[model samples]
Target: MVYTAPGSAAFSRKRGSMADKITAELALIDTELAAVELGDIELNSGEILVGNAGNVATAVTPSGDVTVSNAGVTTIGAKKVGKAMLVSESEAVAGNIFVSTGADSAIDEVAVSGDATLAASGALTIADSVLDGSNVANTSPDNVIGAIPVLYRIAVEDASANNDITSTHKFLVTDFWFVGGATPGVAEDTVQLLNGTNAISEAVAKTTDANCLVRATQLNQSTGMIAAGGTIRITSVKNTNVAGTAYVMGIRVA
Candidate 1:
């Protein structure tokens, strides 16, 4: 057996053996380092390193609408988010709206199916008569003819007989008409209107001299504006002369 000093060949051999073991261990470390080398990594600009299984590092290179920097800074591209990403665009239209049919579901259009519909020309129309006078919910007038005065219709039968005609109610005399039946009142015969006894009209003519059929409007009111319980008296110069049928037309005052 040879005794070897610290600097001797045997001692150097022992050191070499330890160095060989260290080199073998270092080889494994070098292999692992080579597997994760910067050259092996395919990271471009805007990339971040991510650890895989068993501590294997991988380069996460942002693509498409996003990017990552070598410093691990990340950014997303602009205008990449479109309507298709947000909604199911199969039902999209110009005037249509996005309507969610169910909760937690994607929204789309149901434009024409609703009460109102829109045309392709951007003209919106209500379905059928949905917005007409009948369907519209509103406080309508109980009487549609608001504030319009009613037409006072005098019955033709009431003024048929030619005599002292007394009105059934208080009346405002407006017009008078006459048609000869066998014996018509003469043209000069004055058909006077009276409120009880006081005369309201000067002389309402029964008929014209040329013809028995006569119509006159706005009879003169002498006594006052109107007559209550008025009487249509045939006052003739020749009294007791026969007179035919006549109509006293007026509005009810009372």
Candidate 2:
């Protein structure tokens, strides 16, 4: 039988059979329910299976923040939210964070709040960089400032030439020494300064000793002997010794 809508309650009660048929036919319309309100709702398994937006289980509040519990995967406003973490075991992190589990790891820019301590497996080098510090500690080999100019040691010995009174023999001077002798009689076993060789103002010579002796000379620029490139030769004039020694100590000014 066909049912007609009327405003009066009597019509509804009288058409009770028609109403039952109408309700059955309209069951599909009820599936498209608008909103639901409930004190609490619990689902028993197998009773309801929620489809995509086919059904909306929960909705956002007016505040725009969402909280979920025990969800394996969820999404909010296009951002995927996972349960605990987003883990990448095989994939790599490009852009800023680059991590190589096996070989190399590098970060483009890193900022630490306090001091930074770096530990390296191999040698760590900060090349072509200036370290601003008042003092520097050198823990390597020998530290060299500048070159020092100094005569180590000198020695003197007998002359190699035979009776060469007028000629001068090249005596290997071990250290700075002097000897002297009388006029023309093998000179004198004396410690006297040579014309251009002796650095001391007065020539020093030993009148009697055959052994070599040292002559003190000023360690300054005024003393022509032992200057920068100047060589001081020890000559055995009256003394037979042709070997002597001289030690020089000076700093490199230039």
Candidate 3:
């Protein structure tokens, strides 16, 4: 039998066994590190990293109109806001204003719908024409004639005949002038206005001697009003004297 020393082949075999175990453990560690690919790992554009409940990290892509912070809070982009309002191209007309329809994000340009008129110094004009006098909504003197003053003139002869003056506009008799006629007595020079059987001015005496008889000195204190589609009848009764011209003027205010 041979006696083996501490540094013999049997001792070398024990050392070789320990070294082989350590190499096997190092190989296992290398295999796990290669699976992670730490050297080749990179984040793509618009890509982010998120962690799940198990603490496992994962790559995520974000939507174009929104962004997510590291804290997981999301926010919308400015251009992606909903229901933005904008004006159209039809707002250039004069005397016109823009109005928003009840519809969502809808608007239009139109003439002022309020009861507005052109100023004395304003040169602006609307495309809409005057309303007809017969329209019930167009009240006379102001709206019927577009607030314009009008005069209805007729020559009256001193005869026992009634002269009826008919007008297409509703007006207010503002003034009267007897140019060529002499002053007739009461019940002799009579002028009356009727608005569909309603007497606006009844039997007003014209007693100014060859002059204008305004409402100030007339026997009737009522405003001589002629409605739309009404008539004014003037009857001259000569008190043994009949000669001259009578001119009637009225102002329109509809």
Weakest ten-residue segment in model 1 by summed lDDT:
149-158
Q: For each of the candidates, give the backbone clash count.
A: 5, 54, 8
Clashing pairs in 1: 46-68, 46-69, 47-68, 47-69, 200-222
Tens-digit lDDT track for model 2 on 1-254?
23334455654555458867568546534643323334235544223324547576544322233433333233353454342234353442222232344535522322222233223333333434343211232221122563323333434334432111111211222123332222221334333223244443233444334443446453223453333234444344435433433332333232
For candidate 2, the per-residue lDDT at 132 reads 23
TM-score of each: 0.29, 0.26, 0.34
> What lDDT tens digits, residue by residue, belong to model 3 across residues 149-196?
455566666665566767676567665544435544443655444444
Worst 10 residues of 3 by lDDT: 212-221
Residue range 58-159, candidate 1, lDDT tens digits:
866668887766676767689986778765656466666567879779675656656877776778777774642223222212334332221222222213
TM-score of 2: 0.26
C-alpha root-mean-square deviation, candidate 2: 19.7
- C-alpha displacement of 237 in model 3, angstroms? 1.4
Under the 3 Å rule for N, CA and C atoms, how many clashes does model 2 have? 54
Q: Which scores greater on TM-score, model 1 or model 3?
A: 3
Tell me the deviation in Å of residue 128 in model 2.
Answer: 32
Q: For candidate 1, what is the lDDT? A: 0.52
Deviating ranges (above 4 Å) for candidate 1: 1-162, 183-186, 204-211, 222-230, 239-242
